[model samples]
Target: MSKEKALAIFTAVPRTHNCAQAVAAGFAREALVDTLHDCGGGRAPEGLCGALHAALLMAPEDRREELRKRFAAGAGSVYCRTLKQELKFPCAECVRLGAALAEEFADKPEIR
Candidate 1:
């Protein structure tokens, strides 16, 4: 899917789905949505951002790491609370970044 579509999905969600879920579900190939849907919320199993967790689930290890590094560099941290509370990172910005990363992953078949 396109980055714009991913961003739309991320921002258009009606409820409080986490960034991880938004990114994962947004860029997921048709067959992967059901599995990736579970990756939403504030903090995932190990206190990771939902977007990061979802990326890990959807992408290969190397791709997931790349996404983590890129997200941390751009957003200052992968944690949702830190991004929203301490840094005051905008949700739209996060969604944009996540969508961009998801697009990168979506474009690479080896990464999926």
Candidate 2:
């Protein structure tokens, strides 16, 4: 899926996609989307932000921590509650950034 289409899915009205769904859908990971259904709203394992969890799921195993670090550097935390309540970062924007950062893994593209 194209980047525009991915972002559109995340921003769709009536909001079907959760943070993980939105991020996974961005990279055409339809299967991941289903598995992540219950992972949003701070429910991800270890309290991970759903969007970051989905992005890490797509990267190489050895690179997951790196991706987490990179994501945290941008968002100030990898957990949903921190981002939502403490940092005041928005979920929609988290999905957008998570998908964009994950794209860098697939295409080796520089951060946009």
Q: Worst 10-residue stretch by lDDT in candidate 2?
A: 103-112
**Which ranges in model 2 have alpha carbons more than 4 Å from their true place?**
109-112
TM-score of 1: 0.71
lDDT of candidate 2 over 5-90, digit per residue (tens) = 56788889988988888888877889999999998899999999998888889887767777899999999999999999999999
RMSD of each: 3.6, 3.1
Our model 2 lands, by Cα RMSD against the true structure, at: 3.1
Residues 1-112 of candidate 1: C-alpha lDDT, one tens digit per residue: 5556656777774853455556655665545445555555554666656666666666666677787888899889988778778899886677777777766775776624
Give the TM-score of each candidate. Answer: 0.71, 0.90
In model 1, the runs with Cα more than 4 Å from the true position are 16-18, 28-41, 108-112
Candidate 2 TM-score to native = 0.90
User: All candidates' lDDT scores?
Assistant: 0.67, 0.85
What global local distance difference test value does model 2 have? 0.85
**Candidate 1 local distance difference test against the native:** 0.67
